[model samples]
Target: MRVWPLLPCLSALFSAPVSAEADDASGITVTAPRLERSLEREPAALTRLEGRALAPARSGRNLGEVLEAVPGIAVTNRHNFAQGVRLSSRGFGARSAFGIRGLRLHLDGLPLTLPDGQSQVDTVDLDSVVATEVRRGPASVPYGNAAGGVVDLRTAEGFTGPDGARLALQGGSHGLRKAHLRVADADEAGAWHLAAGDLSQTGHRDQSRVDKRLARFSTTRLLAGGRELRIIAGAMDTPFAEDPGGLTRAQWEADRGAADPDAVTLDAGQRADQQDAGVIWRDPASLPGEIRARLFASRRDFEQQLPFVFPGAENRVGYQRAFHGLRLAYGDDRRWGGVPVTALVGLDADRQADDRVRFVVDEQRRVQEQTVDERQTATAAGLFARAGFGLGAASEVTLGLRLDRLRLAVDDRHAGSVDDSGSRTFTEPSGGLGITRQWGEQTLYANATTAFESPTFVELADPDGGGGMNPDLEPQRAVNREVGARGPLGDAARWELALYSVRVRNELIPFERAGRDFYENAGSTRREGVEAGLDWAPAAGWSLRAALTAADYRFVDFEDREGNDYGGNELPGLARWRGELVARRDLGPGGLALAARYQGRRFADNANEVRVGPRTVADLRAHWRRGGWRLFAAVENVADVDYPANIRVNNDAGYYFEPAPGRALRVGLAIPLR
Candidate 1:
């Protein structure tokens, strides 16, 4: 509360200041542009967060808790470990109920998102991550199949200076226990790193506990002729992660920690195991250009129980999936017509096959019926090229183009239904143009791009017990335009701000009927938003970070089957305003940190009924270090705010709210060995 006065004074002084020379540090060099370009000059809306900023919220078992304040990004549902984090960038992924959609996730340069535009971040080794980069706005031209956003989680390569190791232990409220170990060394074998960890929590809500274990290994080896090779591998096992489901308004008011009756009755939960490995090869320096190629493969086995049951059908489902992919890229630093140019060309391709089954549960909990037997396959391929050209000294223009083709297929083996097999393919050519001009430490930018997204096979399925795909289902498409400016705010602060709008056609919407969920395409939709972020190091021992967002997402033209003319209404899942602020004060050997977050009230369905959100929560953490050991503690929801944190839109009943956790505490220790 004391930080409020600084805002007015800081603005007034800035608006009425004399001209001065800017002293600013440049942004980091990142691969978010696929060009290994410098963030300060790159003509895109990109942001990067270092690992040191994520340590405070690492034990929450929800990624949203860790990445809460990133600009143009929204991460919520901190208490729902079962369905994973609900993350969105600029309203792109707001409709997702579970897992991640409309975004791409990459770990150690390997794609975690499948070819069908579906992804989950639970397998990421958060304890071992060193950095993360977010690419915002329409991205079809650079990454195929996702129009929302892209997140890249990078891990530590190794220690080039000396050998070191770290051991960490954690204990928290709600029966939380976590431990992690990491080691890095450099010797005659080049450089290598190893990390392993396990964590469990009997969550704040009933029937929502989770147990998970993970391991990661990475190494880089010098090859003959000055070439190099890098390898990365990961393994994960999650024995149990219960799902409490959603609660109605009355139910939420009665008890915020109680599980949904249906979820408790069915014992809803999931278990999963996953493993993946990747290899990267670099060409010799003598080659015409810098050439790098990658190969990767992954396997996942999973099972889950639904909250409801159909008498003759199944409520339990299982999945086994195999995935493989490759990426090849070439970049050249040269001049075209006496102007500096950085041009990159790349190819991406991936294939995935999933085998699924469903089993009925009778009174005795036996497999009474074999209701579903099917295999789904998806393939994607893309070719893209981008070039940046320097215009004069402090201005540049960039252009890029990508051609992508994706195919989805389903092979139904259900004996009770006729052959419901089907296949669909789509090809799209997308591109973007960007311009940036710099004046001292200030940079001005503008971008115009096109985006496309084909529905996942499951989203195209009819909810009326029909096994075949809906013939009328179609892909969603959009165009985005944005402009923004970023620069230093004196020597104590930095700011990045942007405003944009997007127009979309055939926007997908979800609906539930008789316990089955299905999707429909709206005629048109519009989204307009503004995003702002600031990092202020007011003094030597004090640091502050703030972010504010306001967006208006509305349906332009559409009507449901019941002749309901709903032409103008706010989108179901997006809130109009959101804000977050974090501050830290160092006390030599120890530090105190505080964070506050706010979300405005928003609708729970297309009809603008059942509003949720509009809550503010504060969190605090303190830590001290001496020698190679450190101890820390954290308290979340310091004010014990009561609010619905999640909404399951368009449900059969008026059960959309998911209560958030109240006050909780955690304490841990970290020891480093050298």
Candidate 2:
């Protein structure tokens, strides 16, 4: 594949020598673990992306632009809004059929991943985010539940920049149109920020269009005695997002922009409206040490029309969902026996309820007869504790443990239908141990961790097409061993490398039956991978960031329902090699950036019969500022490469490919409101 040749270039850059001027990020601290600590002492693989460097000249389209360069992760389904973007870490979330699964997402300390292990990022305001942190592998043991990895986003609190309002307008190819406005101010007592935006587009493929609007508000108050209070609220509305369902390879080869005929015929699409609010309170210096608490709630109204059609089966689904959560924690820093110690204890509780209904659709896509109606509920709680003890001034050891309980239940409400009410309960424990050693400016770390993931309500749906849960579905468990090192290279650059091996039991795998998605357990699976990254400031006004990941994921023991042995087969939908290169340059009042991403070949089925080819895509962005005005432009897919943006794994109907757009252009202007 073409991506192979770039590997040598990346290796040479990582090994190159540099000067002795200290990098600006050498003393950076991370807040991903709810603790403030230097990155050098952290015993895990973590990447922090600064929004200031990423958001200024970008097309405010999706999260892929913000996260694609991070190593050990994959982002796909970029052109489809109805299904949202698919994010996978170390092959953990590769089997997700719809929303995000097997990973935890948080925005401003509030959990975006529901108790049912489903997440949607449509509500996140990318323009307002200030930073993002991603933790890979089993290091996410403290968060509990489907935490194959963790993504945390922190937005601007409106107090840093000048007190002013800015208005932005953008227009581009494919009938794209967008408008955004942001206002912020601060005083001695508090600070406030408000933002609103609207976007509409005519996509590259037939039957693919999207219209969306978003609004957000945030405020912070300075309380007495070193205490603080923060409040946040956001709303999102998508009038319609058409789904141009996956197409067969032959169809794609014939016409890359062709949509699935079934999708067009069935008018497959989705509509969603959501609102969320949250509050956080913190006491930095209390009698019992530092204390923090958070409360959040959200409501969503969603409806969708699928391309699936069957007698006595539903193809139109609608749901009203309510989700809420609360978290509390306490941390203390003390010295015992002349050694420094830091400890934290926390509790997390969350609940989700859905009132769902489904109906059979006619040729015109109108609902005909009701087929299923049910109320689903999921509750999850966890208690966790972590401690770190300083072995010496240059070394530390950390230990963490968490116990979690999850309950899922469904109540059949359909009249004159067979009752399929059922419930499932799971209790699991996760733990991690780690040690870090510092040698001058370099640090070495090793960790062993355990994690468990219970089946979500959607994943537990019976394969027999019933209304209740699957009786045989069980939670998946994983154990990971990892070693890594990170430090400065000649003071002008920073580098990190990690090697990890993971073993999974009862691994969850997805399949399609009669046009509907279902999940089953693989007897065993193994994943081993290496990730490397580099950041260098070669000269003033110039910077480069590069990352590469190579993973080998396979089934150790697995047999299908038809008794087909998948053992020794490579897991589908994940590539063995992925890499990204980004370069940025400053020109006084203007800046420019270029990014190229490469994805290696992968499989579209568990049997490894269908192979997806590799491709490399590049994007260019530039911005110029004068006085109080700024103009920006972006060119996506600069090389006009044709590639499969997403691959639907193990599809029985031979529908697997979703082609990405060739080339697109966008230009925008930002005006300061006096």
Give the candidate number with the greatest lDDT: 2
lDDT string for model 2 (1-674, tens) is 12323334433332333334323236678778666677876788888988444547766678877785788989999889988889999888889888688889999889899987888999988877878899999644578988898999887788887689999999998888999899999999989999899999988899889999999999999988889999999999999999998989899988889888878988888999999999999998676679999999999999998866666556788999999999999988899899898888999999999999888897777778987788999999999998889875667898999999999999988884567689999989999998877666677777889988888887898987565689888999999877777888996788898888889999999998877788999999998888999888899989888999988899999998889999999999999999998899989999998989999999999999999989999999899999889999999999999898889888989999989998999999999999
CA shift of 177, model 2, Å: 0.7
What's the lDDT for all of these models? 0.81, 0.86
Q: Write the per-residue lDDT of candidate 1 for residues 218-299, one digit (tens) a residue.
A: 9999777778889999999999999888888999999999888878877888999999999988884867778989999999
Query: Candidate 2: deviation at residue 234, Å?
Result: 0.7
**How much is the lDDT of residue 546 in candidate 2?**
90
Show the lowest summed lDDT stretch of 10 residues, model 2.
Answer: 1-10
What is the model-wide C-alpha lDDT for candidate 1?
0.81
